[model samples]
Target: MAEILAFAGSNSSTSINYELVKYTASLIENHKVQTLDMARYPFPMYSADEEKQKGFSNSLIEFKGYIQQSQGLILSVNEHNGNPSGYFKNLLDWLSRLERRFLEDTTVFLMAASPGKRGGIGAMGVVQDILPRFGAEIASTFSLPSFGQVFANGEIIDQTLKEQHSEALDIFLQKLN
Candidate 1:
């Protein structure tokens, strides 16, 4: 069975994006799912001066290890001001320094969601553009809009949106098999 790592790109304990990622992971029938919360694996703000002096933080090292071990990835990132959250971007920078192609050979199902209409598409674009450079094969991408209205009880309630997400997940799972 493939081991897929699922995570949210935010530090908030009550992150809606995290909820969306976990819910999507549950849709997969035949995979081992490991969920990561950024709040637990905290890292200091990255800077050139910091790396020059202290080297990579243990948290970043552990994160890279997770990426290396996983066969697939399901990540949902939150948008802050039409871009990915600064914390996630910082994590990306640190991971890139550890290995240029940190997600090499892994298939990724990228997703984003928000309470508003745009549905975090801006943040999704950031991941879609960058992950490929790191050798991540994007199996599919999804964006959930009006998160509060469309999602309930840990499931997507809107029929059209649910079917769309299901199709994306099917494509991703096929790549895993």
Candidate 2:
């Protein structure tokens, strides 16, 4: 089984993206999947001055270590005004500072979800473009639109969405080996 790391990009306590990560992690019981709570690993705002002053924190090192140990990632990102949340973007900045290719050789099962009709497509588009800069290869992608209407009770309620999720998961798993 692949060593998979899963996390949502939002720090909100009631994050719907977190729900999406949890649900996706559940479907891959056969794999050794580790889930991270982003709220617990919050990093300071990224700035060149801060980097020069303090260097990488222990939490940042630990987070980068997790990515290094994983063969695959199941990341669900949240959108804020058509871009990824600032919190997640900050974390990525720190991770990159530690090593530009911190996610080197990792296969990512990218995901995004939103309560809006477009899901988190805008943020997903940006993420899809940037993750490769950190050495992550896109394995597959799944987006959940109108999250409240389609997902609930710890699962995807809509049949068509459920099938699409399964297919995406399958594509990701195939790349692990």
Name the TM-score of candidate 1: 0.97
> Which pairs of residues have clashing backbones in candidate 2?
none
lDDT values of the candidates? Answer: 0.92, 0.94
Error of 1 at 101 (Å): 0.6
Model 1 over residues 16-42: C-alpha lDDT tens digits? 999998899888877889999877877
Q: In TM-score terms, which candidate is top?
A: 2
Task: State the lDDT of candidate 2 residue by residue for 64-142, as single tens digits.
Answer: 9999999999999999999999998999999988999998999999999999999999999999999999999999999
- Tell how far residue 156 is off in model 1, in angstroms: 0.8
